[model samples]
Target: MLLQGGAFSACNLAIIENRRLPGWICNAAPSGRLGRAHSSRVMSVATGEQMSKPHAPTHQPSLANRLRLGSLADDGLSYKEKFIVRCYEVGINKTATVETIANLLQEIGCNHAQSVGFSTDGFATTLSMRQLHLIWVTARMHIEIYKYPAWSDVIEIETWCQSEGRIGTRRDWILKNYANGEVIGRATSKWVMMNQDTRRLQKVTDDVRDEVLFYCPKELRLAFPEKNNASLKKIAKLDEAAAYSRAGLVPRRSDLDMNQHVNNVAYIGWVLESMPQEIIDSHELQTITLDYKRECQHDDIVDSLTSPESAMTESVSELQGSNGSPTSANSENDCLQFLHLLRLSSDGSEINRCRTEWRKKPAKR
Candidate 1:
C-alpha cells in the first residue's frame, strides 16, 4: 500500500515518474532490485493521491518506461534525472539545503555509472576494480548555487565523467529548474582510486582506464569552462590558528555511507558547526570548495575550525590576486567569505580543508 510521506525501506526501490501527478512507484523487492513483484504501490505524496492497483507480477516495465525515471541524455555521455524536493530535504528558509544538493549530485553520479554498465559493488567502481579490492575516493569538489529550489520543486540534474590524467577522473554536473529550464547550479569534482585493504592511493590500471574511457565523450565538455573559470582555482588551506573552532564533533551512526565511513556531505555540516551565527543567519552559501585529505571513521573525534578570509590575508593573498579583486558592483551584493578546516582530534591530522563564500540574503519585502 502507498504510504504518504513515508520513507522507503532499504529493500524497496522507488522509481519516480514526472507526470500530471509526479510520484514514486516503489517495488518492495529484496535489495531494492527490480524484479517480478506485484506488490508495487504508487506513492504520490505531492498531491496525496490514492494508491493505484498493483501491476501484474508476471509483467515488467519496458526499457523505455524504466528509462523515463533516469536515462542517458541525447549526448549519450551524460545521465539526467529529475527529483522532487521533499519536505524533509528543505530547511527553515523553505528551500533545499546544501547537504540535500550534495546528496543529489552523488545520487546522479552513481546512476550515471550504473547506466554505463559499471560494477555496482561500490561508487562507480569497475568489475576489475572490485576484483583488485579498489574504490574511488574524492580528491576535490567545487559547487556554486545561483538559486535554491524550494520544497516540492522538481529539479533536473545531469552529470558526466571524464578522465583527469592517468591518476584521477573528473565529473561535472548541471542542475536546472525543471519547470522552466533555468540553470540553478553547477558542480565539478575530482576523484582517485584507492586500495580498500591497504588504504593506499592506486594508479588507474589500463583495464580500468579502458573500461571507463569507452563511455566518456570523445570531445571534452565541461560544466564550468576554463576561460572564465574563477571557481576552478585551487582552494587555500585553512590554518590551525582559526579564530573559531568546535571540538569533539563526532559522527552519528547515520552519517556513514555504504563505504562504512563518514559521508562527504556530513563533512559540510561539521564544517558549518563552527561558523559564526551572524553569517549563518544573515547570509546564504553561494559557493563552496572542499579538498579532502583523509577519511574519518565513526569513532574518530573531529574539530572544525573556521576563519574569515580577510583574516588570512598573508596566506591567501595570491589566490585573491589570481581571481581578481572584489569590486563594488552593487552595495547590496557584498559577500562574506571564510576558510574552513576539519581535522582529527587525536593527532591533529587534516581531514578536509574548505573555502566558502556567502551572499547577503535579500531583505523581506
Candidate 2:
C-alpha cells in the first residue's frame, strides 16, 4: 500500500542512483583457508555494519579479534566516526535506506564501546578474567529521520554513552552531511547485558560503569526520552487474517553474522520485502521503530506480515493505474501506516515487530 497523504509536501531531498563508491580492494591475502580478515585491510573505514556480529550465547567465536584490541583506548573515551555513504546502503529511492541508517547508528554506538576497550571480545575477555561473560543486546531503539543522504554522500556519525540504569545503558547519535554539515538524523537506543551462562538479565556492574562512565557525556546531543515497553504500542500476532504477507525467505550464509544468527538489520529488510511494489515505487519511508523479540538462527524460515491502517477501498473507477490495478497514483491522498511482524515459519515464533510511517514521494519537477 502507498502512503495515503492528503498533500505531497516538499522537502530538501536529493537523489543518486546506487553505485559502488570508488575504492580499491586490498591486495593482502585472505586471512586463512576459511577466508577471514585477521590483519586489518587498508581500505577506508566504513561503518562496522559488515564486520561487527551480534554475539550469541549459544555459539563460540569462529573469527577472533575482528574487534581490534588497538581500536580501544586504555582510558575509555568516545569519539566521532566517519563513514562514506555507499551505493548498496541506499534503497530504490537512491537515499540511505532505513536499514543502512540503523546499522550506522548501531555501529557507532558499539564502536564507541570498542574504542573504549569494551568490544565484544574485549568485554568477554574482561569478564572472563573474572569468570563471567555478558552479551550486549539492544532492547529498544527509536529513530527519527529528518533527511536521508544519497549514494557517495559522505556523512559523519557521532555516538556517546549516556547513563546506565539497573539493567540498561542508553546511547544516542547525531548524523550530519559531510559536505554541508546539515543535521540529518538523531536516534536513541537502550541496551541491556545478558549473562551468557544463566541466560538471564544482568545488572550493570562496577566494571561496566568504570569502563563506560569515563566516556559518558554530560549533556545529550538529542533530547530523546528514555524508551520503555510501556511507551510504545504492542504488536499483535498476525494469522491468516492479515492483509499483506510474504513467506519462504530462508536465511542465507551471508545473512548470518559472527554470532551465527541473523543480523538485526536483516529483519528490517525482510519486513520491507513484504511491502507492495506499488507502494515502494511511489513512497518514501519516513520513520520506523523496531522491537526485537527473539534471535533467529540460520536454519529458520521467516515470514513477513504487515497490517495496513487503512483498508483498500473497493473501487476500480478512478484509482486505477496504467496497468489495471488499484493504485493511489498521483493522488494527494496517499500515505501508509504499517504494523509489521516477522516470525519463523515453523513454530510461528515472532522474531521482531515494527511500526513504520511513509510519506508520498514528491512529484519530480
Candidate 3:
C-alpha cells in the first residue's frame, strides 16, 4: 500500500490496505505468518486494548511487488524492504512528536523481520529450535530526525538487517516522504535474543546466524557505530533542585509487547511526561538516544526523572564506570537537551536511561 500526501486522501488507501492485515503490524501483535483463516476471529490480547472494529483480511504481496515497493537497490544482494504507513491521529503531537516516529520505526523493523521469516514462532516451527525459548530484545536505539511528519502524512520506511553476531544483530532504516520521495530520517538498532524460560541471555546460534546472514549484504553502505559508546556510557544524575520526577507510573497491558515486557517505544512517552510543560510546548524533539539496561514488566512500578541541560553538570569522564553508564552527560547546543532516567519505583533498579535534544518550533511559513 503506497500512500501519497496532501491530507486524509493520502491516508485513505494506506489505511484501507493495512486493515486487510490479519493482525496489527505492531510489536504487540502475534508472531508468524497471519493467514486468512484467522482473520475473522477476535484477537485474544494479553495486556493491550482490543480493536473496536472487526479483524481485517490479510494481504500477502507477490515477491516481485515486494521488491519493487522496497525499491530494492540491487537484486539478489539486498533484502531491504519498504513499508508504507500512515501517521494516525493518536500518534500526532502538537507538532507530530518524536515518540511517534520511534513507534513507526519499531513497526517496520518487526515487519521486515517477519517478511524474511525470522519471527519468534518461525524459530520454533521452521528451524525446530524450540528448546532455546527464544525472544528478541532491542539492546540499543539511536535515531536522528531531520523532519517530523505530521498526521495524515504518508511515510515509506525502508529497512534491512545486518549480519548477526554471536550476541547481537543490527537493523537499519530510512524513512521517506511518500509523495515526493524526500528523505525523512534514519535509525539503527541493535538486538539480541534471550531465553524466555531461563531469563538468561542467549547467544545467536549457528542456525540463526546462517539464516540471517543469507539476507545481510556484507557491503551494504548503511552504517552504525560498533559500540554505541557515547549513547551507552553516558549517565544522567538528578538532584532535587534541578530535576523533575514522576513516580509510581505503572505499565499498562497496552505497553507490553509480544514478549510480555514493556515495549521500548513506550519509554519515550514516559520520559517525556517528566519534562517541564514549557519546554514541551515550545520545542520539538530532534534526536534521541536510549540504552536499554533492563526490562520492565507489567507489574513493575516505574519512575521517570528528567533534568534540563542546565542541571546536568557532570562530564563524560566522570560517568565512565558509574551504574554501567546507562546514559550520557548533557552538553550545550542550539537545541535544548534533557537527561532522563526510568527506574523501578520499588528498589530504584534502573530500567533504562535516555538523552533527548529538542529544537525550537520553526516560524510559520
Candidate 4:
C-alpha cells in the first residue's frame, strides 16, 4: 500500500491481536527504494485497535557539527581545534583579517579553559571567582603572523596556558594551515585577575592558582622562546606628537562582549583606524604587540593616534644602528615599525598602547 503523497510504500503487513479491534501494521520504505524499509507505521482503522504510531526519525547531526570543536591534544596538556575560515572572516585581500585571527585565538583559549572545568560562567571564571565577582583581564598580547588563510581554508590552532607568576598566567597558541601543515602564526598573552565590582586588579588566590596549575604541563613549552624576546620586548609609549589621529571613534554595540566591555579585538581595529593609508596599502603586518592599560565602555569616545618609528630619528638609530650610510640604515628589507595609542577623547586617558611591525608587500607578477 502507498502512504500519503505516494512517497512511501508500505510492505510486510502483519496482523496484530488487540483487545479492542484488529489492525494492520507494516514497515514503510521510500517508493524509490522499496526493498529497503526505513520506518514502521500502523494503519488507522474505523474500529479502535491499538494503532501503531510512526517511529521517530533517525537522529542526524546538525550543521554545526561540521565545525571541529576543541579537544585535548594527545599529550593532554594543550587543546587543539580546526576552523574553516568563513567568508565573513576574510578581508579585501582574500585572507583572514588580523582581528579574525585574534578572535580565533581568544576562542580557543576560552575553550581550553572550559575543557579543563575552569569556566563555570561564560567568561572563563571559576566558581570561586564568580562568587567573588572576579574576572580575567588581558594585560599584554604579542602576535606574529607569517601567513593568513583565505576564505574556506581549514586552519588548526593549538593553545595552552601556564602560570606566569604568583599574580598572573600566560597563554600561548600556534596556528597552522591544516591542508599543508604549514605554521602560519603564533601568539602569546598575559592575563591577570581583576575585581569586577571595584574595577581594580587582584592577585591570584591560592585556590585559583591550584585549580589552574593542575592542568598546566610540568615542563615549560613556549611558542616564542626567550631568544625571540627582542620582538616581544616592551613597547615604548608613543610620547611624541601624533603623526596621524582619528578622533570621535565610538564602539559599536557589537564590539561589547559578554563581559560588557569592548573586546580586545575591537581595540586592534581602532588602533589601525589612525594608520596612514599608504602604509596600510604598501605593507603587511608582521608583528603586533598590545599593552592594554584600561578597559573601554560602549559610550566612551576614543582617539586613535599613530606615529611612525622612522620619524623618531634617535629611536630609529637605536633600533637599527646607522653605519654612517643612509642606504644601509634604510634598507628595503628593514621592517617598518609604528607606534599606536588609543586614548579616551574625554580626558585623554590611555586605553591601549600598540607597537606594529610591517613588511613591504611583494609586487604582483
Question: By lDDT, who's the top model here?
Answer: 1
lDDT of 3 by residue, 1-365 (tens): 00000111112224323322223221112322332212223233321445555434234443442344442233222234444444443332533567667776765554444433333342211132344566667777877666666656677776667755797577776666677776666676777777777657778888767645654666653533334423344656544453788888988888886667888888888888798888867776766878788888889998899887664322323213211221222345447877888888899888887887777765542
Candidate 2 lands at a TM-score of 0.66
| Local accuracy of candidate 2 as per-residue lDDT tens digits, 1-365 | 00000110011000001111111111111223111221112112233344443111122222322432212222123345568779888766678888889888766655444323333442212332224666656666666565677888888776666656566566666677767766676666666666656646678787665434434654553324333321244545555567788998888887775545566677778989888887788777765767777777788899898877544221113212211121233232565677788888998888887777676776541
User: lDDT tens string, model 4, 173-284?
Assistant: 8888888777777788888887888979899888667656655777887777645353467777887499999999999999987678888888899999999999889887
Query: Global lDDT of each model?
Result: 0.68, 0.54, 0.56, 0.66
Using all chains and alpha carbons, the TM-scores for the candidates as numbered come to: 0.76, 0.66, 0.68, 0.75
Local lDDT at 20 for model 1: 20
Which residue pairs clash in candidate 1?
A: none
Ranking by TM-score: 1, 4, 3, 2
Using lDDT as the yardstick, the better of models 2 and 3 is: 3
Error of 4 at 315 (Å): 16
Ranking by lDDT: 1, 4, 3, 2
Which residue pairs collide, candidate 2? 3-334, 3-335, 3-336, 4-334, 4-335, 5-334, 5-335
Residue 40 C-alpha lDDT in model 1:
29
Q: Least lDDT summed over 10 consecutive residues: which range in candidate 4?
A: 1-10
TM-score-superior candidate, 3 or 4:
4
Q: Write the per-residue lDDT of candidate 1 for residues 4-99, one digit (tens) a residue.
A: 001221111212111121121222222123321112212333345545643333224334335545765543467778999999999888899999
User: For all the candidates, what are their Cα RMSDs to the real structure?
Assistant: 11.7, 16.1, 13.3, 16.8
